[model samples]
Target: MSTILVTGGTGTLGVPLVERLRALGHEVRVLSRRSPTHPVDLREGTGLDAAMAGAEVVVHCASAPRGGDDVAAGHLIRAARRSGTVTNVVYVSIVGVDVVPLGYYRTKLAVERLLEGSGLGFTILRTTQFHDLLARVVGAAAKLPVVPLPSGVRVQPIAVEEVADRLAELAVPTPAGRVPDLGGPEVRTLAQWGRVYLAATGGRRRVVPLPLAGKAYAGFRRGGNLAPGRAVGRITFEEFLARRDRTGA
Candidate 1:
C-alpha cells in the first residue's frame, strides 16, 4: 500500500474519499486547515510540505468555495514538486467549469490550466454537483417564502460517494491527464431538483422560476458544462434524497 494524501479530507466528498482509501488499505493522510493528523493550509503553504513529504499519490480535494482555486492549486503543485516525493496528483474538479461563467467555476478552470501546465503527473477528474450540496442550497432557499430558481437550468448531480470512489481510482496510479467527466444518472432541471428537495425534507415553499440573464445563466441554459455521454454515476437524485436525512452514508 502506498501513502496517499487527501486534501480537504474532511469535506462532503473528502470524508467518503478518505474512508474508501483506508478501506483499500492504503496509508492515508488527510490534509486540511484543521486536520489534527496532517494539518496543512494550501492557501498559506503551512505544513503542506510536511504533509506532502512522503505522499506517493496526492488527491487534491480541497477548494476555496468562495474562490481562489487557482492559487490553492498553484501552492500545492509547487509544494509537491519541492517534495519530489509525490508521483501523482489527482484533482477533483467541477464539470462544465471550463465553460461555466460563475466565479467559482472560473477558479476551477484556472486550476485545471495551472495543473495542465505544471508538468507534474496529474489527473483532473471533473464531476457534476453533489446531491448533498444541492440539498443544502435548496434547504437554505426554502427559508424564503418563494424559492427562486433560474429558468431552464438543468443539473446532473452525483453522489459524493461516487465522486470519492472516482478520485480514489484515479489516485492509485500514475496520472492520466483530464479524465472523462462524471455525472449523475439522470439530468433534471433545477426546478425539478428543488421539488425533489422540498418533498424529501418536507419543506413547503413556492418554487418561483425567474428568467436569469448573464453569461453564466446563458451558459447554464445552454448546458455548456454538462457531459451527458460521460454520465457514469449510478445513484439517482431520488435515491440520494431517500438517504439525505441519514448522516454520512
Candidate 2:
C-alpha cells in the first residue's frame, strides 16, 4: 500500500477522506498540531518534512477557517517539495476561489498558484460549499428573530462525504491540474435554503433578503461560484437537512 499523508486529517473534508483512504488499504498519516503521530505546523514549516517523508501522496485539506489559508498552503508546498518521494499534492479548494473577491478565496487561489509554480505533480479539486458549512450558516442565522440572506445568491452545496470519496480517488491517481469542479445535486438561492433549514429544525424566523452591493455579491449573482457543468455530488439539500434533523447535529 502507498503511504499517504493527509494534512488537516481532522477537518471537515479531511476526516472522511482519511477514513476512506484507510479503508481502501492505503497507509494513512494524519497531520495534526496536537497529535504526536503526525504533529506538524504548515504555517511555520515545523515538523512538516518529518510528516511528509516517505509519503507518496499528500492530500492537503488543512485550512484556517477564519483566515491564513495562503500561509498554510505555502507551508505544505515547501514540505512536499522537500519530500522527494512526494508525487502528487492534492488540494481541496473552493469552486469560486479564482473569481471570488473574498479574502479566503484569494488565499485559496494563491495556494493553487504555489502548487503550480513548485513544478510538482498536483491536483486541485475545486468544490462548492459543503452542506455542513451551509448548515452552520443557517444555524447562526436561526439565532436571530429575523434571518438575513443575500439576494440573488444561489449555492450548490455538496456532501463532504461524497467529496471525501472523490479526494481519495484523486489521491490514488496521477496529478491533474484543477480537476472538474464538484457541486451539489441542485442549486438553490440562499432564501430558499434558509426556509428549508428553518422548517427542518422546527424554527420560526422571518427571512429577509439583503440586496448587497460588492464584488462578492456580484460574483455570486452571476453564479461565478457554481460549476453546474460539473455537478457530480448526488446528495440534495433536502436530504442533507433530513440527515441533520435525524442526527440532531
Candidate 3:
C-alpha cells in the first residue's frame, strides 16, 4: 500500500477522497492547518516537510478561492521536492482555468504549470464546478429580492463524490499529466439552475438577467468554463439537491 498525503483533507472534496483512499488500503496522511496530527499550513510551509515524509503520493486538494493559492502551491512543491519519497503529485484543477480569465482560475493554471516543471511525477484532473458551489451561488443570489444572473452563462455541475473517485484513481505512483476533463451529466443556464434551486428550497424570487462586463464574465458567457463533450458525471444537480434535503445538510 502506498503512503499518501492529502492536503486540505478535511474539505468538501478532500474528505471523500481520503475516505476512498483509506478504503482502498492506502495509508492516508491528512495535512491541514488545523489537523491534530499533521498541522501544516500550506501558505506558510511550516511542518510540511515533516508531514510529507514517506508519502509516496500527494493529492493536492487545498485551495483558497479568495487568493494565495499560488503561494500554497509553491510551498507544496518545495516540500515535496525536499521529501524525496513523494513520487506522484495529483492535482484537482477547474476546467477552463486556462481560458476563464478569473483570478482563481488563473491561480489554478499557474499551479498546474508549477507542477509540470517541479521535476516530479504529476497528474492533473480538471473538472467542472461542483454542485455545492452552484447551489451556494444561487442560494446567495436568491436572498435578494431580485436575483441577478449573468446574461448568457451555463454551468455543468459535477458531484464532489464522483470527482473524489476520479482523484483517488489517479493518486497512484504513476503520473498521467493532464487527463480528460470531467463534467456533469447536464448543461443548463444560470437561470435554469436558479429556478431549480428555488423549487428545491421553496424560495420565491424574481430572477433577472444582468449583462456583465469584463473578460472573466465574457469567458463565462462564451462557455469557456464548460465541457459539454466530457459530461461523464452521473449525478445531476437536482439529484444532489434531493440528497441534501434528505440529509438536512
lDDT string, candidate 1, 42-73, tens digits: 88788888888778898988887787778788
Q: What tens-digit string does per-residue lDDT give for candidate 2 at 1-249?
A: 789999889888888898899999999999888977878877787888888878889988988868888888887887778888889999999999888788788888988999999888999999999999999887798799899989889989999999999998999647888788888888999989999889888888988888999897898999988989988899887898898778876
lDDT of 3 by residue, 184-204 (tens): 999999988999999988988
Off by over 4 Å in 1: 246-249
Please report how far candidate 2 places residue 96 from its true position, in Å: 1.2
Could you tell me how far off, in angstroms, the CA of residue 43 lies in candidate 1 after the best superposition? Answer: 0.9
lDDT of 2: 0.87
Off by over 4 Å in 3: none
User: Cα deviation of 129 in candidate 1 (Å)?
Assistant: 0.7
The TM-score-based order of candidates, best leading, equals 3, 2, 1
For all candidates, what are the clash counts? 1, 0, 0
Which ten-residue region of model 1 has the weakest summed lDDT?
240-249
Candidate 2 Cα deviation (angstroms), residue 36:
1.8
Q: What Cα-based lDDT does every candidate model obtain?
A: 0.85, 0.87, 0.93
TM-score of 1: 0.94
Candidate closer to the true structure by lDDT (higher is better), 2 or 3 = 3
